[model samples]
Target chain A: GAGVSQSPSNKVTEKGKDVELRCDPISGHTALYWYRQSLGQGLEFLIYFQGNSAPDKSGLPSDRFSAERTGGSVSTLTIQRTQQEDSAVYLCASSPTSGTEAFFGQGTRLTVV
Target chain B: AQRVTQPEKLLSVFKGAPVELKCNYSYSGSPELFWYVQYSRQRLQLLLRHISRESIKGFTADLNKGETSFHLKKPFAQEEDSAMYYCALGGGRGSRLTFGEGTQLTVNP
Candidate 1:
């Protein structure tokens, strides 16, 4: 893809439901990242994937938040038993490699009612 | 841990006026700082990075390790500069970037 692509641009779910956000990174990109943006707030780091190495999960807020990347191209962010506080836009980004300027996705706005 | 801090949540400036958006960081090692922006109904985009040491859209940022700051400055503010700005830090062998709370800059005419 020419740019990072995220699925289901908007999502609304009941509290405690599980939601999955998907990201398709640019071709040949080696780094993928997921972030959360609350209402009128900054991007919150969630997880990072570089190649086949272990992912950096340091930023995941809780055990309910998890992510996985397959074949180093597509990634998914899963938030289980979502809470009201989880209502936010989930953004995904990809860089040609680590330490480079990243390109971002349109983001999936999740609304936990 | 590496973190980015943007002091102001809202900044208002007049057209052609000089403007500055403050940012600070905390890290154990050398920090790679970046400024990202978001226009209305647009996705977040990178503005500039400390390592590049380049200016974009008349905005420049100098990384000062002595004070742990990377402030974005512009000599003449434009109406199009009215947007949300975020300061971010990227380093420590991770692909992720840590971002600040963001500052909404409004360049008034």
Candidate 2:
């Protein structure tokens, strides 16, 4: 893809239900990132991936929020047991390498009811 | 820990007015600072980086190590510049960015 792509531009789920958001990063990019954007909160770092391995997961809000990338390309963010506070835009970005400019996806708006 | 702070959540300015968006960060090592902007209904894009020292669309930001601030400034604001601006800090190689809360800039004609 010419840019980072996120699936299901919008997702609404009931409390306690699990949801999975997917991301397809730009081809050949070695670095991928996940962020959560809430109203007034800005972008919160969630995870960072380098070649399919996550070197940083400290930003994950809780254990229920987990993510993984495979083939050094597509990635998935799974939220177990959604909460109302979890409602936010989940953004995905990819860079040619670490510490470089990142290209972002349109973002998946997750609304937990 | 690395963190970025943007004090203003909203800013308004008349066209051709000077504008400044303040940003401050706390990082142990020399950090990479960047300004990202998002126009209405558009994706977030890079406006400039402190490392480049180049101006983009008339906007520039300088990283002040003594003050730990990277403030974005422009001599003349334009309507097209109205958007949400974010300040981000990176810990260097293999590190993720820490973003500020962002400021919504509105330029009234």
Identify the runs in model 1 with alpha carbons over 4 angstroms from their true place. B92-95
**lDDT score, candidate 2, position B109:** 100
lDDT, candidate 1, A17-102, per-residue tens: 99999999999989999999898777788888888889989889999999999988999999999999999999999988775678
The two-chain DockQ for each candidate, comma-separated, is 0.54, 0.64
Question: Which residue pairs collide, candidate 1?
Answer: none
True contacts kept of each: 0.48, 0.56
TM per candidate comes to: 0.91, 0.92
- The sequence of per-residue lDDT tens digits that candidate 2 reaches over residues B1-109 is 8889999999999999999999999998989999999888787888999899999999999999999999999999999999999998888776676789899999999
Give the C-alpha miss distance for residue A14 in model 2, angstroms. Answer: 2.5
Error of 2 at A107 (Å): 0.1
Estimate the Cα RMSD of every predicted model relative to the unseen true structure. 1.9, 1.7
